[model samples]
Target: MSSFLKVLFRNVLNGPSTDPFPLGETFTPDRLRGKVLIDPELCMGCGTCKEVCTAGAIDLSELADGSGFRITVWQNSCCLCASCRHYCPTGAASLIPDWHAAHPEEDKYVRIEQQTVKYEPCSNCGTLMRPIPAKLARKLYASSPELDPEQLRHLCPACRRLRDALKGRPFPVAAAKVPAEAQA
Candidate 1:
């Protein structure tokens, strides 16, 4: 009886070992993974984040009309691994560890981040396939010496292949003329 009372007194004096969360301010530790942020201006909608996301937190979809693309990241589904940030080619995805979100038992916790970008069609086939981010386009143009920005850069893979194949072919008349000229 004496020991029980002493223990109770000690607990009262020392207070609770656990933090008073929800009722009191939640303490966020260092390197807290809070939320994922995607900069619409910087993001190219390349689907790199979507490919790298192991938790399936990031989603990329094209608009039904084929005019643009929509990129979405679900906060609740995210594991806070930051793989999307690392794999992002444009450096658009980032983690903002500012504040810890308050989660309630009854309600669904969700913070959906969405961004949209317009699609650039293929030059020859007019296929709306590539999402040419301005920064990526500029970088490619600057680095590739053989890439002609004005004429060749915009062609799709199929069109470029066809053009190359045609360039390599010799006309039947030219081959025949070569033999006749040699005989003469």
Candidate 2:
């Protein structure tokens, strides 16, 4: 009893071993994993994030109207491994340091992070296509001043390929298929 009293007195004088988290600032370290986020504008609907997710927490689906794609991240299923963020081609997947993921068991299924990325019609061919974001387009075509990135942004894949292959050449039989507006 005397020894116990001595230990108790020492501990009391030393102060609380654990922080009062609810009433005070919690210890959040740098590089802490918290909420998974997807930037709709930056994301190109590539399945790289879903493919790299270690926990199988990410899902990609086409919208019902076929206008866009949807990405879903199950917060509860994510193991906070951050593989998605690391492997994302566009740097669209990220984690914010707002670790408020805890919730009652009943809410587990509803805890999800979702975003939609829409498609635009190709200006040349009138086909639906994902537009190359201006930033990425500029990076890809920066060295080629002859190729206008903004103009090519409106072309479908086939038209863009044709334009690139026939940049300095005359209009061949195949090139005749491109309309006057698309040719210019």
The most accurate candidate by TM-score is 2
Candidate 2 residue 53 C-alpha distance from true site, Å:
1.4
Clashes of each: 0, 0
- Give the Cα error of residue 88 in candidate 2, in Å: 0.8
Query: In candidate 2, what are the lDDT values of residues 1-184, reduced to their tens digit?
Result: 9999999999999998889888887888777888899988788888998898889999999999999999999998899898998998778888988887678889978999999888998775666778888878888889989877887777777767776688756436645456545545
TM-score of each: 0.56, 0.78
| Model 1 steric clash total | 0
lDDT of each: 0.72, 0.83
Give the alpha carbon lDDT tens digit for every residue of 1-184 in model 1: 9999999999999998888776787677667778899887678776888988989988898889989788989887889899988898888998887666666855454467888877667665565545445666667678766655555546555555655666745333434233234334
Off by over 4 Å in 1: 1-32, 103-110, 122-125, 145-184
TM-score of 1: 0.56
